[model samples]
Target: MATTFENLLYDLDAATGILTLTVNRPNKLNALNATTIAELGQAIAQARQDGAVRGILLTGSGEKAFVAGADIAELAQLSGPAAQEAAARGQAVFREFETSPKPVVAAVNGFALGGGCELAMACHIRVAAEHARFGQPEVNLGLLPGYGGTQRLVQLVGKGKALELLLTADQVKADEALRLGLANHVVP
Candidate 1:
């Protein structure tokens, strides 16, 4: 089906029964701006409702990031209420993926930090390439993950590991992430 949303960069091929949704803004490392988040939500909803699609793959457009995080430029200007609304919208979108009936896989080829990491965690399964890196560095920016990161990370790695990662605001390599059970599979 043809979609009006261009920023999301969706490619749905009927023959393969695979729907691929790519974060198109490689220049910005495919950061989750309001528009990108909206488009992503729409795309996932469409895919889930479409009967032909058996599986969905979410990925970034470039090798730099699966999604670096939220758009810091846009987020930096938000006031109290605006920030709250942004968080709410993000939560709703990510929740759609988490509860999606069809299987969703995240192909993490690079940096998946903050919201990026949360995005991957929302998927049914995650496959990270050798070059992929994951982290919850929101603390460094004087913010916490506003998009389900705290709960999901704790569920995957337990409270101790989750707290260490969140508190330190450190990046974990793919191997370490797999060892900690943060990733389902790590590939070269």
Candidate 2:
């Protein structure tokens, strides 16, 4: 049976022992808002504690996005300290994938920008659909990636490419993402 915690849906595969986490915000392109992030963190913690969950597959609900980015509306209202706190919360939540004893894989079906890209980077592996797109367009908003994007992007792609992307805020398509080492695989 699948369980939903606010904006996240958690389903454990009986045969494969793989838990799938779906970010359930298609209307907003599964954007990472504060509530959604909190729900996602809770679901991940639950999966980690569940003995039946051997691994995790993370994705978004709609075909249009696997999390387009952070919720811009919520971000616009934040005070300086509040914004910092929000970024810290998102970073800690994304860190769960790295610290998880069970492997966490990202199924990058569509857009993965800003916090979305950082979230994918936290995973042990990433598989992208042919139409998937990745970027850290925080620069366009006068903000740098606040969710470990700089560090993880550098670790995945080389420092040169990471810096270029960070500075340009240019989106990378699936094939280029695979070639650049941002994604492990790209399927057509």
Candidate 3:
């Protein structure tokens, strides 16, 4: 069965007990805005509470991107304190994967930049499509990845690679990401 939320599409497989959550904003490449992030948190909470759901597979709508990044328009409107709070809220939502008893996996179909990359890092396992790209490019906007990117990236790819990627703001292709230990597997 499937249920559609404002910014998300959820489907559950009774046979496999796998719940798939799709960020449903293909027009925007499933950009992470406050509302979308909140909706994701709600979905996570719901899945955690439902015994029928054994695991979650997180992905984005469309073939072009898993999530391009945060919504620049929405992000640009935040004040200093507002920015801090927003980051906290986003981090909290992503952190659910770590605390949840059920595993959360990320299916990176395309671009996963900034908060998108951060989201992938939160997953217990990550698999990327052949054309997928990953990066933390917040530095281009004079900001840093505030949604656990620093810590998670370090943990996944090690400090040296993490620091280099952060400093360069360079995107890595699926093969490179897998080779660097950023992605567990790559798919066609």
Candidate 4:
């Protein structure tokens, strides 16, 4: 059976007990907005409580991106308290995947930038498609990644490389991601 939300698609593989959660916002390249973040939290909570769900496979809807980044439109409107709250909410949701007892795997099919990269890093394992690209590009906007990207990028790829990427806003391809230990596997 499949459960559909405004911005997500939750499908269960009964035989394997795997829940596939797709970020369904191809028009926005699966950007993480506040509503999407809240929905993800709700879904993760449900998966945690459901015995039928043994693991999770997270991915985006389109071939262009797993998640391109946060919703830039919404981000442009943030102010004092709202910005902090949004960052906190995003961090908390990503932390849920990080601490999940059941494995949470990211299937990175394409661009995983900024918050997208942070989300992928939070997963227990990351599987990237051959054309996948990962990076923390918030520096280009005169800002830093606000959703645990800095810390997780450092943890996955080491401080030197993480700093380089964060500083330059350069992207790494799937093979490089695997070599750097950011991705467990790369597929065709």
TM-score of each: 0.97, 0.98, 0.98, 0.98
lDDT of 1 by residue, 36-91 (tens): 99998889889889999888999999898999999999999999899999999999
Ranking by lDDT: 3, 4, 2, 1
Comparison by TM-score, 1 against 4, better one? 4
RMSD of 3: 0.9
lDDT of prediction 4: 0.94
CA lDDT of each prediction against the hidden true structure: 0.91, 0.93, 0.94, 0.94
Selected candidate, larger lDDT, 2 vs 4: 4
Report lDDT (Cα) of residue 139, candidate 3: 91
Cα-lDDT of candidate 1: 0.91
Worst 10 residues of 3 by lDDT: 1-10
Better of 1 and 4 by lDDT: 4
Model 2: per-residue Cα lDDT over 1-188, one tens digit each: 57768888899998889999999999999999999989888988898889999999999999999989999999999999999999999999999877899999999989999999999999999999999999999999999999899999999999999999999999999999999999999987
Worst 10 residues of 4 by lDDT: 1-10
In model 3, the runs with Cα more than 4 Å from the true position are: none
